[model samples]
Target: MSTVFDIEQKQDSAERLLAVADKEPRYILFADEFNKVARKTVESAIHNIELDFSWSKFKNQKQYNVNGIKQVHLLRMQMKESWILDAADEVWLLIDRYKPKRTIGTSGKLKSSGFKHAIYPDPDNPKRPSEILITGKDMILDFGQAFYFKYFSDDAHTAIGYGNKNLYQNRSWVYLRFRLKVRKGDKTYYSNSKGVIEMLVKNDYPIGKTLDYKLV
Candidate 1:
């Protein structure tokens, strides 16, 4: 009978060793350590931009009219294409796995007319029954299935609750707001590049605080 204390001690030792190994300095490094840090900082900023855009696209689905909003534009050319392709691949993979009989959006927007599938249980009608519900697993499966249906169809319209451009722009604003909140004590001095690097140094590499904080 191994005691619980022994098990805990073993786990703790393993974790410490792993952390030490991860931090071990490597020789013959392809890039200078400082250069690596600078590169990673740029990569993270690009990722944040992509995430901001994705969140915006999700929000646009909720708006009734999207014509008034400025068309979503990608400022960084190379990063923009990479983000779109990665997003499309993720959606494609999800669609392949779930294989939903029919897909519907939040506002009762149906993906296909002839396809037959049961709706998730309605909260208002507690007695109603279906194969799907609003749990986390079901949501994941639904996204995968929905992606496939839309990608394959010639007349596939945007999924419900996410088609409006304004929704995405508002989403981008919200993402920027929260990021600034986490990075800076005051919102007035939030520059996407510098703020993020400062936050990372504060949280991850405190020793690197003396380094000049710049994206490139």
Candidate 2:
């Protein structure tokens, strides 16, 4: 007998939840089996997702009140499965869809000895790696209160210089451009933060339909 939780794989959709009724003994299954399938689904979605940036329009406002503490509901985003909340590793925001015209490869290596913070490994810990890797995709720069892409640099321990040092700081928003995943109780919902503009993810090539959003 298959419960409401027993899911069946299909050719085109992942939302087809199977709930079969039969008289049989119930036995626990291996946890790894579910994890493998979930990871594969997420990985495929990430690689095949069509980021539609055409709908996004950048507007300039001088006296803007940036509130970093408001939660907005996503009109079209949905979380069909509950297991994904615990299985997903990191939620990354794809800042750059395409590579920059000019790049000096990956960013400089950050030595643990150079920094005094606990985030960096200490010399006393033999098991810890000596340097923390900061790739080009991992870096983002803030300009005039707004976050901007930091191009890769060949310089040691530095990103390619942009504008003046005073105007550029390494800072990022908690959530930017939709792709919000929130959890409340057993169910998880996807939405963008308030005061943030929407950037919908359209499953055009690999999957069908679009995960669009709107402010609540």
The sequence of per-residue lDDT tens digits that candidate 2 reaches over residues 95-210 is 21111133445765442311121222445432322222212222221211211222222211111123232122322111133233333334333333212332222223332222
Model 1 lDDT, full chain set: 0.23
Which candidate gets the maximum TM-score versus the true structure?
A: 2
lDDT (Cα atoms) of all candidates against the true structure: 0.23, 0.28
- Reference-based lDDT, residue 49, model 2: 31
lDDT of residue 112 for candidate 1: 44
- RMSD of each candidate relative to the true structure: 22.8, 17.3
- Clash list (residue pairs), candidate 1: 56-168, 60-164, 61-161, 61-162, 61-163, 62-161, 94-144, 95-144
lDDT at residue 160 of model 1 (Cα atoms): 27
lDDT (Cα, 0-100) at 111 in candidate 1: 62
Displacement of residue 139 (Cα, Å) in model 1 is: 25
The digit string of per-residue lDDT tens for model 1 on 1-216 reads: 321111111123455556566564563232345445544553444335421112222322332112222222211111222332322212111000112234465677656432122343446433322232212111221121121111112212222223331122122110011111011111111113211111001111221111011121
lDDT of model 2 at position 208: 29
Query: Best lDDT goes to which candidate?
Result: 2
